[model samples]
Target chain A: MKIEEFSSDHLDVLKELMNIAMGNATASIADLLQAFGTMHIPHLTITDMDGLKSQINHTISADEKYYVTKQLFGGIIGGEFIFVMTDESAANLGHYLYDVSQPSDADIMDAVIELTNILSSTIISRLTEELNTKVQFFAPSTQIISGNHIIGQDETLNYHKIIIVSTEMEFQSHKISGYIFILARDETITRLRELIDQKLEELYA
Target chain B: MKFLVVDDSKLARLSLIKTLKEYEPTAECIEAENGAVAVELFKAESPRVVFLDLTMPVMDGYEALKLMMQIDSNAQVVVVSADIQTQAQVQVLALGAKLMVPKPINSDKMLGILQQLVF
Candidate 1:
């Protein structure tokens, strides 16, 4: 599955919408941390299943591995939203928010969970409003591991193309990045495509 | 009465504005993208109260607080941020901020603070 399924205009709208969504996420995070900070909206990219796998692998290096938190939301718009943060980035965010000279592993874990909650909630809210759909989100589950853990073989699992959008944030002097991935079934994708087309037509007209 | 809100995020600013409207319907609300503009606006408008975000580009909350203090020692400036740690809270408190509120701006908490400062 290629991102070409959606028109450039659709992608543009999605990107803009995600920018606002990500901003909300950071704002909620800032509120949660009680720290004054700014979030820079990162670039968004659309990728196929293979592309996503490679992207995930490339993002997690030997020195800096990725921590992923997965949450399922059901209702008007339903799908899995995954937020990926680098271990180093998570530590920096924790220290910055807490105003601590150093951060503990527990601090990093707590921050990741909190940050994921904010991002997921904000994105889901925005998506629902823009799509004019009613959706529900389930509890978020998290995984923190090395890059090798992500790349290890798991033949039993079924694979589908995922839409990944990334945003970079700087909070309290810490540089952190956020990723939102929507894993959809084929039927869901069809509905999403129709929604995108309708939105694009409205935008252009 | 007029109020000034300072934050770098558009969404936060929007959220804050929406919440403030419920509390102060007739109060005029103004916004600044960062602390520097916030200080400038404070000097020009002398708003009844100021909602300030601590971390911002060009100038941060501490510097902005110092500037506001130098301009108007009795300024009613409230620190609004997401960082809730004890040290950060104490640091802002020491900077002469009248009060500190966490982010997402709870309506009840905000009304309490507003009632204490403005009423």
Candidate 2:
């Protein structure tokens, strides 16, 4: 079934699964940074490229410069993971990750990519394990860009429907925050829906 | 006893309620989709205890706990949120929550929380 065909029960179960996955990533990042952090509840939506862009733009301000990272994962269930963080947050992350007073640009880039890797792998692995599936992740790419351009204006989205599972991670003491978006489309959505259905059957049984 | 379970996800609320039932077979539950609704229900239902989730749309558990305490100083609130940061736990407790436990509550954890409550 397509994303629009998802029942309320399916959406609810998927959301709870995302919550558990994101929570695991939050704890992992907290340990890496040696700081306590909070992860917001996951927001799941089915939209096209334009709608996804609009949602991201609404959540992230257009005034700041951000470090945007993207990673692709493929298997029975596959998707793209996008992470966006403010430039200032990236710098703070460098200091927190590398313990440097004034980290150079290389330090910032390295830290951002590493952080993205940790978040993507932790969240995807946890989610896949729960769904009884496995995935292989590709190397992530990072770029410094304006917040407005964090999500590229590529209208050439391959799929007619996109499933976006997004959340925010914040560290109060470090004043660091980031947004994570997991996008899946095409056949993956069908597989995911089936898995969610199986989970629902188990829940109701 | 009557319990109030608050969460944006119906699955979460259902799971918590099921575990609560396992702990107390005859217990009654009232569900709220967010902290705003939880507050309204709190005033109307006066549930014996509340199991709250911190990150919810419209309103969050922290605000709800603060408001609940203001309305009834003796309110019993246990935050069951995925945000397990130390700061989050301390903040909820400072706002007068009886305790803050992580999400996906099972029967044993529910039993522990129920036993920890005086009334």
Candidate 3:
């Protein structure tokens, strides 16, 4: 099914669920830093690679340096979760989590990976559970790179579409606002709709 | 005069409390981060009403609701979650939720529940 074929009801459900999942993720970051965080209303969309990149670039250019983290998950459906932030934001986060104002490069990377692992796993696992599907995720990996390096990967899943589920998270006491995303494969979109429809039947019908 | 709100998000819990305050200015609220803590709070405080989130770490709402039932079968639980799909609602109802309230809650819904729970 084409990405546009996804009904508004299905998209709404995904958005609502994503809001909570990402809220949980933001809470993890808060606990990591011992500070409160605020979650922006999530932006939910479905598009091809070019559109996805364009949407992201509308806010921050791809060429800008960003700390990118990635994790892969598989089960009834599969997808990649990507977290992005400016280099300065990453450093601020790392410093806060490490309790140092000027952490070394290695310390920053360690903070990034540990932070990403917690945030990514929490969001994806919460989302999958809410959707009533079991999923398994591998260890997360992080790098200080550009956003282009993230959406620029080639996939062998034979899927031409991705569900771009994203939100901006900001620390209440800190000046760090970053992006968190879940790019679900084409097949995963179909499966998600099926599960949602089944859920609709059980609740409304 | 007491309510228990269980959610992993501190922001969300605060939001719920804000809404609950509209109708229950004097009602006491106890917060829990997960189902395990929720069960413990239910034992310690015995709040008259509960607002439970279904997808939480440690133990999910389903298990929490079941255990709460075992402890106090009369507990009035309103399942609060973003996962309000029909299957989710049915499951929570089967697990013994009095009603299901989706996340991003507002005052009207909370006032309604407060009216029912209080008077």
Candidate 4:
């Protein structure tokens, strides 16, 4: 089925599934940081690469430098998770995760990668478990960009249409926030549609 | 037998209302898309119990809970949200929430919540 063919029932089920998965992931993050965090409702959208770029533009402002992390998860339903956080947010993460008042550059990168792994692995793992699928995660990479340098500029993502599952996570007390984008392209979209269909069937039946 | 169901997602509202009806078949449920409307409904309708979601557009559950408590100290609001952080739980309880549970409320969980309610 085409991405546009997704019905309201399908989107609702998908959003609920995301809520459950993200709930579990947020608990893990809270435990890791020993702090409280809030997750926004998961937003599902089907868009081209340019549209994805536009969303990133809308989410991550051009005024501040950001440390963007990307991790790929592969299997029948494979996709990449992109996490974007401002430089100050990254530093705050380092401090909170490691209790370092003045975290170095390496400290910031390490903290970002660690946080990304926790967020992506817990979320995707729970989501796949609900879908009855298995996935393998690759090492994550981080890049520092400022002033109009978006994260999705990689030439490899040339798909005509992609599914973007996006959310925002915030630790209000710590003043740290990040935007997470999970991109599923081509075959992955088809697989997601099938999985969602099965889920809807189970729910309605 | 009046209850307020507040969530931005129609699916969540439907799911919760469906589960709730199994326990209280004659329960009247009022729905709201966001916290702003929820507060208004709480003021006007005065639902016996409220099932609120934390992460929403316009206003969030935290502010809504605070307002509801200010309007009526005895208001019963159960926070159903994706944010399961311990601090979130503490924050809501401190704000006078009756209970804080996670998303996707099923029949069994709904029964437990209802059984615990004093009203």
Which candidate leads in DockQ? 4
Each model's lDDT: 0.69, 0.87, 0.78, 0.86
Q: Show pairs that collide, candidate 3.
A: none
Clash pairs, candidate 4, are none
List candidate 2 segments past 4 Å from native: A60-65, A147-159
Worst 10 residues of 2 chain A by lDDT: A151-160
Instruction: Name the DockQ score for candidate 4.
Output: 0.58
Candidates, ranked, DockQ: 4, 2, 3, 1
Off-target runs (Cα >4 Å) in candidate 4 are: A62-64, A146-159
Q: Per-residue CA lDDT of candidate 2, range B1-119, in tens?
A: 88999999888888888778876888889999999999999999999999999888899888899999999999999999777667678888999999888876877788889889942
After aligning candidate 1 to the native by TM-score, how far in Å is the CA of B80 from where it should be? 22
Judged by whole-model lDDT over C-alpha atoms, candidate 3 comes out at 0.78
Model 1 misplaced regions, further than 4 Å: A1-4, A36-46, A92-107, A155-159, A175-185, B1-119
User: Which tens-of-lDDT digit does each residue in A1-205 have in candidate 3?
Assistant: 5556788667756666677777667666766776656545577788877767777777667678888888888999798888787888778877887889899888878887787788878888888887788889888777777766666577344447878888776774776767888888678989988887775454343
Tens digit of per-residue lDDT, candidate 4, span B1-119:
99999998887888788889877989999999899999999999999999999988899999999999999999999999877778889899999999988877888878889989943
Task: Give the least accurate 10-residue stretch of model 2 chain B, judged by summed lDDT.
Answer: B81-90
Per-residue lDDT over A36-118 for candidate 2, one digit per residue giving the tens place of the 0 to 100 score: 88668788888888888889889888877889999999999999999999888999999888898999999999999999999
